[model samples]
Every structure is written in structure tokens, then in C-alpha cells.
Target: MRKKRRYIIVMATCILCFFGIIYFIVPKILFYTQMYDNRINVAIKNATDIHDLLEEAIHCIEKRQYYSAIKLYQKVVQDYPYHKKTEGAQHAIGSCYEWAGNYKKAKEAYNIFMKKYPDSKLAEICRQHVVELDNPIYRKVNDAMVDKPEQLDKIIKKCQKIVNNSSGQKKTDAMLKMGECYFLKKEYLMAIEIYQEIISNYPDYSRIREVEQMIGVCQGLLGNYGKR
Candidate 1:
């Protein structure tokens, strides 16, 4: 009788442990397995139009999920090719690749975009991107100069020269680079001035939104400095 009681107790405990593992560990395994796949499918299914798809792709970009963002943008290009915003979605794919450090893919995407939408307002922007991606000075500012603040003054001089010699698209990009250099040097006022120059000189620049946001950030930094 005693041996039978002990055996029954052991069996019950083993069963409970097995159920606990299934309840906790198994769900975790399944959740991780389906994480990206399930969310992406749901996001696509819930999208009713190209705008919805574009919004979701932007959200994915904010989350740093560039691959998923690309998928969403591709869906827009494939499913709603004639939509007005389709060109924007296509351009966004290149932007995502650029942000993700895949400059080669970004250049390819931008080239394809320019070919497909030759008269687009963004075409000049894409041409500028292609030029910069191929430029050693631009590459240095983007890839290494920001990390090495000691070289920022040198970069600023180079960008100022570009701004002086170039016009339209190239000038706008060089001004943006100079703003970044000033911002890195903690010269918030100078950064804001450079950004404002872009706004005044190139109202239709594709990155106007980004420039505005940088100005806002610079103001906030100035306010913090005042407090300190």
C-alpha cells in the first residue's frame, strides 16, 4: 500500500510538470516562430488600400524592420501600380535600404524609380542620391565622419564648397551635411541656421520634413542648454 501511494504521488507530480512545460515553454516557442510572419500577414490583410499599406510600411521602418517594410512597399508597387502614391512607396523602399546601410541596393532601387517615374518630383532627389552614394566625400560624411567628430570641421568645409559651386539638388544636400556637422559640434544655433537656409532656398526639397524636424530638435537642445 505504501509503495503504491508513493508511485501515485510521483506520477501526479510528473504529469503536472509536463503540463506546466507545455503551457509556458511551448507557447513561447510558437510565439517566436510566428512573430514576424504572423504580424506581417495580419498587417497586409488589414490594409485596404495603398495608403494603408504605405502607413504600415512607415511604421515598420520606425521599428527598424526594413525587410518587412520592403515587402509592404513592394505590395503597393505590385498591386496598385497606377495609384498616385505608388511612386512614393517605391521611393520609400530605396530610402529603407539606404537607412539600413545597404547603399548598393538603395542605389539600384533609386535608379529603377527614376527610370519608371522619369518626370516625378522625386526624380531629381533620386539623381542626387545616386550621385552621393557614388561620391567618396558623401560616403565619408555618412559612414564615418559623424562617428568621428574631429573630422566634422573638415567635412563642413567640403560641404560649404559644394554648396557654393552647386545649385538646386546638390546645394540642398550639401547644406544638410553642413547642418549635421554643426549639430555634432554642439553648435545648435549654427545647425538651425544652416537648416533654415535649406528651407528658404529649397522649399520643394524632398527632405524638407526631415530638415524641419532637425530644426525642432535643435531648438529643444537650445532650451535644455538654457536650463543647464
Candidate 2:
């Protein structure tokens, strides 16, 4: 049964990766990013050992309900310690934390996973994650922004460097962060312009609706400020 369950999990991971945005899977729940295709849903549902907690956790992740998903994944680990999917559950807790922008907690969770599953196939991946998170540049911009939010210009510059260096979804993410910095700085016109660029350049961005909403809000605010 364990072997069968492991095989199912591995196969599902492969399918999800091939079908979804492949560049980054660990940071986002794999199947969740692909618009929740019915086949993925069916596969998860059919995986009997992963019935409720893991399945629901994936749903929460799809909805960007990171904390909720973290709880569900933690439940899977705590309540079913010996379950075939426990390693995945443990790893997912870190992924949820990373997606939620809690890099410190994500690193801690990955470290715990490495310790618990030293010989598991995911251990090497966890080690890579640990190395990635330890890099100050990866989290510095966000962390500094949080520490000195009034320094919006500095943060935007940092985000711009990220945008300049990255491509595809990574660039989209950096652009969104830069737009957010503008919005927070009350530079409504600038925020709207950035958001518009995102709409134009990255039509397939997953958070398109949210980006549109941000633009709308910026426009309304600009009008109120007599800048429109």
C-alpha cells in the first residue's frame, strides 16, 4: 500500500509539473497554479491516503489561503505521522510559508523537513531550498521594505533590479511588487501605469484580476486627489 501510494504521489507530481508553470513549483503548489484542472482534482480525490487534509490543503493553496493551507498540511503531518504522504505534507508546510512571504518560517520548516527525512528523496531538494533562503538578496528587498516602509523609493529600486534581471513569471512578480510599492507610496498614477504595463505584457498572470482591481483603486484615488 505504501509503495502504491508513493507511486501515485510521484506520478501526480510529474503530471502537475509538466502541465503547470514549470519554472517554480515549490514556491507555489504545483497543481494549484494551473487553474485547477478537473483531472488534477480527480487524481487528488482518488489518492485515498491523501483524502481530506492534503486535498483540502491544496485547495487552500490554490485560493492563496496560505495560513489555512499551512494548518491543513501541519495536520496531515501531526495526525498521520506514518502516512505515505507525510513527507510531502512536511515539505508543503514550507512551501506555504514561502508563498505567504514568510521566508524565515519557510527556511525553518525546510530545515525541519531535512532533519526528519534525511534519507528521503526530498532531502536534497530541501538542502537546495535552505541554500536559496539563506541568500540575503532573495529576501532583503522585502525584508527591508517591511522594516522601513517609508523608504518606498529604495524598495521600488530594489524591485526594479529584480524585474530587470528576471523574466517570465519572476519578472511579473517583481513588477507586481514594484507596483505595490508605488501604491503604498500614494503614487497613484505611477501605480496605475505599472499595473497597466503588467496587464499589457503579462496577460496570463495568475493574479490578473487582483492587478486589475489595484489599477481601478489607483484610478479612483487619483481622481480624488485631482490628478486624473
Candidate 3:
């Protein structure tokens, strides 16, 4: 009877140990497994969003709806700041400015892209664009100078002067240019503020449509899509 009782006690202890392993170890294993899966799902979703936004921007470009394209590309940058697709979106923004006949703005965009992605494959191409736009021949037509990384403050100063002195449509345009300068500098919050100012103060401005779109772009770039 004594031996039997000892045997029974040992079996009970073994059963409790087995349940303790289940109560602790199994849940931990499952929890980590789920957490890893969650991370993978998040990664997949990010990749999908980036891909879709980039494709939409390209579609807009093909249709020549530049404003639309720019807004979409801006979202790509803001949504996934360092994503693989971000570099291409940034490149497209510069190209769009050039195509829109905004040469000075083009130079800002191109120069900034080069600076931000100094090691990128697109860096050399962006540099060529800056050189071409800053060429005397091109300058004669557009009066545009490529604002180097070192000259961003100067560019902002010039735009600010225009804002301080200009009137009517010119003033509104200058304000927009100032905002663009900020955007190129990646001072996105400042850019958004300027764009919003244009919308509020220049309601009758002919390019209100463009200004509104710019605000949307800046907001998107600032990760303020909820407001957009």
C-alpha cells in the first residue's frame, strides 16, 4: 500500500509538470509565431501600397495629368519614406516639374533628388538634368539656375523676396514657388503651411486649382493625408 501510494504521487507530479509546460511554453511558442506572421503581413501590405501608388503615378503621367501624378507620387514618398519605390517616385516629381515648363522649380527638384540620394543610380542622371537646366543656353530661355545643395537658403531667399514684393497673380505664383522651394528642401510641414496659406488668401487666384493640388501633395508628403 505504501509503494502504491508513492507511485500515485509521482504520477500526479509528472502530470502537473506536463500541464505547466503547456500553460507556459506552448502559449509562448504560439505567441511568437503569430507575432512573426503579423510582421510579415505588415511588410506585404507596405509593398503592395507602394507598388499601387507608383503604378497610379505612372498612369497619371501617361495621361498627362501631371498634377494628379505628382499628388500620387508624393503619397508614395510620405507613406513609405525609405521604401524601395520612394527613389523612383522622387525622380518622377523632378521630371514632372520640367515637363510642366517650371524650369527653376525643375532644377530645385532635380538638385534635391540628387542630394537626398547621392548614392543612388539616379544621382548621375539628376546631376545631368541640373547641369542642362543651369546651362547658359537654357538659362537664356527660362532664366533658371540650378540651386545646389549648398544654395537652398539662397533659393528660398529669392522666392521670399518675390513673395514680399509681388502683387496680384504674380504674388500668388510667388507664394506657390516659395512653397515649392520648401518642398524641395524636404521641409514638408513648412511647404504644407505655405500651400494652405495660398488656398486661404488667394481664393480668386487663377491657379487656385494648382495651388490646392500642391497643398494636397505637400500634406501627403508630410503624412497628413487625413487632412488631405
Candidate 4:
């Protein structure tokens, strides 16, 4: 009787150990497999959705339906804020505003993107737009030089100061405006010199063709039309 009792106890302990291993180890492995499958499915679904939205938005933009494109891009930005497409969505929003001729809103959107992603590749493009929008003072000075020719020397001096102090597009515009001031003052030689400086030094400037034309006009005024 004592031997039978001991045998029964040993069998019970062995059965419990087997059940424990099955319960803990088997379920843990199954759980991890299920979790990985779920994650993969979710990633695939998200990727599909992102691709669809981007394609639709691009199509709308190509059709010149800027508002529709903006709406889709906004959805992309809101839904996938942490996705890589978010930055592109932000840039597209700015472009949409610009295409719609909403310059103020475009500027605001671009400024926001610049502030958030200062080191992004899009930052340089946004900076260029901002520079173009913010040069009202330069435009005003150029207009004053054209409209009020009696103050040509004073305007030229002022524009030269701006050129010396400013950089990038602002400096280029100031240099061009200085040349205009000289042209209005009938200082054709000085105007040609400034225009040549711009053509050589600021090749990337937007006014390159206009400066070339002005240089030709200055040459003509100086009786050097044959050179032109």
C-alpha cells in the first residue's frame, strides 16, 4: 500500500509539470506569432492607404484642381502625421495655396514648414518663396527710382547700400535697381557696368534676361550698338 501511494504522487507531479510547460511556453510562442502577423498586416494596410492618397493627390494637382489636391494632402498630413509623407504633404499644401493664387496663405504655410523642418530639403525652396514675397520695399524703391528721376543719384546710393548689406535675392534685386537708377540718370556707362557685374556674379538671379536687355540698351545709348 505505501509503494502504491508514492507511485501515484510521482505521476501526479509529472503530469502537473507537463501541463505547466505546455501552458506557458506554447502559448507564449503562439502569442508572439500572432502579434507579428498583426503588425505586418497593419503596416501593409497603412502603406497601401498612403500610396492611394498620394496618387490621388498628385492626379488632382496634375489636373490643376488645386483645391481638391490640397484637401487630399491635408488628409494625408492629418492621418499620417508621423509618416514620411507628412513633410511632402506640408510642402504640397503650400504649393496648392500658391497655385490658387492665395499668396498670403501660401506664405503662412511655407513659414510653418520652415519653422518645423528647418533642415529639410524643402526649407531652401520655402526660403526662396519667402524672399520673393517679402521684397515689397525693394519693389517700392525701384518704382520710386523710375517715377522720380530727379532723385536718381540718391536712389542709386540707397540701393547700393542695400546691395552691400543684404544677401541672396534681396542683394540681387538691389543691384539691378541700382543699375536702373543709373540708367534713369543717363549714366549709361555706369549702368552697363552694374548690369555686367550682375550677369557675371549673380547668374542664378531671376532678372538675368532683363539685365542683358538693359546692358544692350546702355551700349546703344553710349554709341556702342555695334558691340551689342
lDDT of 2 by residue, 174-217 (tens): 79888877766667778889999999989887656557656654
Model 1, span 104-151: residue lDDT tens: 999999999999999877777788789878987667666655447688
Query: Which regions of candidate 2 deviate over 4 angstroms?
Result: 1-49, 140-228
- Clash number for model 1? 0
Global Cα RMSD, each model: 12.2, 21.7, 18.4, 26.2
Task: Please provide, for model 4 over 1-228, each residue's C-alpha lDDT reduced to its tens digit, 9 standing for 90 to 100.
Answer: 999999999999999999998999999998976775464444434556765666556555444556666767777787888887678678778867765656678899899988978987667777776676567864455446545667788877877899889899889878877886776677778888899999899987775755775675466456564244
lDDT of 3 by residue, 86-172 (tens): 876787787687756677777888788888899876677677678877777644423232334446567668778888987887787
Native-to-model Cα distance after best TM-score fit, residue 142 in candidate 1, in Å: 2.8
lDDT of 2: 0.71
Where in model 4 is the C-alpha error above 4 Å?
1-48, 135-228
Clashes of each: 0, 0, 0, 0
Candidate lDDT values, in order = 0.78, 0.71, 0.68, 0.72
Candidate 4's displacement at residue 70, Å, is 0.7
Q: How far out, in Å, is residue 207 in model 1?
A: 7.3
- Candidates 2 and 4: which is better by lDDT? 4
TM-score winner, 1 or 2:
1
Error of 4 at 150 (Å): 38
